[model samples]
Target: MKLISGGRRVAGNDESTTPRTTGTKEGTPSFALPRGVTLLFAIAGGTAVANVYFAQPLLVTLGRDFAISPATLGAVVTLTQLGYGLGLFFIVPLGDLVDRRRLIVMQLLLLAAALTVVGTATIAALLLAGMAAVGLLAVVTQTLVAFAASLAPPAQRGRVVGLVTSGVVTGILLARTVSGLLADLAGWRSVYLTSVALTCALALALHHVLPPRDTAAPSMNYGQLLRSTLTLFAQERLLRLRALLALLIFAAFSTLWSCVALPLSAPPLSLSHTAIGAFGLVGAAGALAATAAGRLNDRGLSQRTTGIGLALLVASWLPLTFARQSLWALAVGVIVLDLAVQAVHVTNQSLIYTLRPDAGSRLIGGYMVFYSLGSALGAIASTALYAVAGWGAVCALGAAISCLALLLWAGTRRRTPASAAAD
Candidate 1:
């Protein structure tokens, strides 16, 4: 029950919040995981993130049958964001308290049930409610991230988070692709069914591969977790900066996806749903940026990595202006955009996870609250702008958000110390 030097915490001590008595080898590869572990990560990340976008590609079809206005149909997305934000505040913090694998399994089961309801809901209100439930359980991604951090060696923390986060990035990118294909082949309902299948499979896979819990960190009730999350938000300036950065970036991100399909699937191009999904494949290049950042983070270049990622964010917006000219330009933009977001996100997490290792789950929850808010605002604004002003407005809005995010980063860069920056 002692605090380590240089602000590092050993677990089980009141003064220091890092989990202790976890019996970890400082430099060992606890990441010597089985195939089941990888499968669980892919499935868990895919299913959780997919909940955010399942309805995006399917909204038009839902509108055709349900007779809801586009604004209301948009609630299918908005309600989900609200629910996800709530879950990030309430559920994600539990990872540091309870056993992560068990929590993940339980949430996966709940998500499966929610997806089932979404697949079968016939009314707009019912569908919205189902989407909310789906999002509530979708915070399972936070648990997976915490679990990965807990298993990683300190030296490789960045790489481990980056690797797992790469899975999450893939999920975010592929959700649209998967939904497009499923919506085209079967029905919009089939998208939910696909998530259900993945959720069930991952629940089983994680049960086998995840390690046992560490007894050092004390488990708390939900109320205690909430207090911890709030305390983190109140105490950590870096958390504020990172959260603000996330909001701006995600706003740009949601705005792009919200409006991109409108142009691609309309007027000049008239792309099919499957074709739009194929476009998502271009974002897979982001995995490289994420991996490179991980290596750089270990090499004490987190600040440089974050700065580069932010620069890429600003640079990525230029190609969208050329959508009227070429598809390749849009593809490159998507890759750069995803790469930038993932790199900054992983670097931010590597810095924050060590801030309060005992509260990893709650810290993530607090950060994601702002993330969800940005997403909702972006999606709403993007669609509304596209409604009146066309693709130019949507693309311009996205670029503006990215520019603002960069501004925020620049404003904060000089003030932070070398350790947090390198971390």
Candidate 2:
């Protein structure tokens, strides 16, 4: 497919067409992004994305501290994810319209400020508002992903994406563990304060390290750019299918994490926040699958990978259902579930990036809208489900969602061309 950028057709499929300004002057040197720089981008992506998840393990504590019920505390995660979904639709498309380096830096600074607001919030309303801002600005993770994709060669795109996605997964898993430990020692507020410092430091480092480039500024206004994403969504069947998979898989993924804390914090388990957070370490094993998934996609196995991942997602709920009886069961389920989620995620991104290399930000942003929505649905529903019907309902909800994803994959897999299927 011909890649379009700024309403003009580019000759090749590679997305790294941003005109380099590094060697335009005497005594200047042109430098491709080294592995080290790419690794930094990965780290930055992880740190930025972690902000949205730090509250998961601390839900019970926050509920008590804020004098709210578990059902009401669900809004904290739901609103943050909701804001992120909105930002994916409204803000992320700007990456194609302006200087990405400037965009990322500015977003990071704003995220740091939002983190401070969350850290210092004394009332529930203030905390929820801050959380919304934090999620809104956290789209820097998408910006960095687009930046990394634009820097890598086509042959290495999947590998680079895999590595960066690994960082994202690591950030997500570790955020729970780290937040629990910090909150145990100093209180929940300290978690956000620590994030504020780290985010600011990373933002400063990125400003100096990112390379300079020029590109044709987009001719369309902001409204036109937003409208075009819908047009692109309508035009690309692969985009629609992959986004549906993201929505379903992520909904299942979120359902577990959202309510897992409640059961662990109560009854026979009676786990501490720190202990609950340790479960995230088990999930970290899934990060290993992300690298493998990327390599598999590079070898044209995305369809096969999706089928396996969906199967794993469905099976994971079985082990998770025994959480009250056996911690080991919960741990095993967490590992399998995370592996399945990341595998599907990496494959989906690899496929979408191929469809429109030039619109990496918009494509990723658009795709993640489904991700955010799924997460919000899961976050909001899991708590209420657990409160009303207990963990049984949560597991059933997760399994049903996984089954829907598998069915969607089966129905569409036959019609998707082999080339587009990458199988």
Candidate 3:
């Protein structure tokens, strides 16, 4: 770890507590959002998520329409995922220094424009650009997470994150189902159009339903904020550990999602698009289970909870390896995978939020950088491996990654002094 002004490192906690101006005056609760803030957070998180995944179910149609090859078609998903990663690292810090609500609304507008452009684009290049734009704007999900963390009393942060995290999972699974259904009946363009409507509604709901400002006044410089993010990775062992775990879990998660299309829609399964998409529902149900589990974290159950969740995630992939013969097996795998992911994800955020309450935006952003990179790697690896070997290769690869993640968490035996610090 490199030294900064603080000698060893500046605590990320500093960033979490720092407030942004322009949203409201000090002592004015910048995000003093309304009583229904929880609902607002869920909607915001869900809406942003829908934008990021709108392309997942449509990749097939996109390839067909644009005459792009599979390797190149994967680029659409790859680039979009990359764009989201970039936003988390770059755009997310602004939430710590600027007005989060304002940033969210602006991002939504930009995302809406990106969707419209994507829906209208005639050329592959233009469509890719539009996809990137949408990906960039989709980082609004991080902002909403930060917002929820900030508003909740410290003790309840886990529950709030768990709830919003559920929205994200729902978006991930539902995007596939909705897009697949709409693309068949209406056209690929209709998917983006539906996103536009959701964005517009979310923007309105946020403005009307969110509370007044509550953030601490901002004083941190851009240099300080950047340094703060890096310092968190350097000084915080648990943050790094949890983040790595997330990367591994999500890699397997993304790998399975990205490759499932090949076996299910082709070869022995020969399933229809709608049928394939419907499988997402099973996964969504898993996410729902994980969300409910989040409530247990604050009750001295975080570690135990995460342990169970990771185990579930590891178990979830088993049925998938042999799932081609039976759709039921595939659905069971989907549920397990989703539950495992959401459980780990919710627990990860719950812990990270406590690390730096002030810089919720920056912290969430930093966390997501790793998450996005992991997802991208998984997606790329899944498709590339499928091309070279087959779904078995991808499944084996995913299983190995999942087991490694489990080992990483299971083997770690140290704990920081912070947990015992004053509650």
Tell me the tens digit of each residue's lDDT in model 1 across 33-111: 2233444564577568877886776666777778877655556677788888888888888887787878988998888
lDDT of all predictions, in order shown? 0.77, 0.85, 0.76
**TM-score head-to-head 2 vs 3, winner:** 2
TM-score of 2: 0.92
Rank by lDDT, highest first.
2, 1, 3
Worst 10 residues of 1 by lDDT: 1-10
Error of 2 at 133 (Å): 0.7
Which of 1 and 3 is the better model by TM-score? 1
Specify the poorest-scoring 10-residue window by lDDT in model 2: 1-10
- For residue 206, what is the lDDT in candidate 2? 85
Best first by TM-score, ranked: 2, 1, 3
Question: TM-scores of the models, in the given order?
Answer: 0.90, 0.92, 0.89
Stretches of candidate 1 off by over 4 Å are: 1-39, 216-220
Question: Better model by lDDT, 1 or 2?
Answer: 2
lDDT of 2: 0.85
Give the Å shift of residue 271 in candidate 1. Answer: 1.3
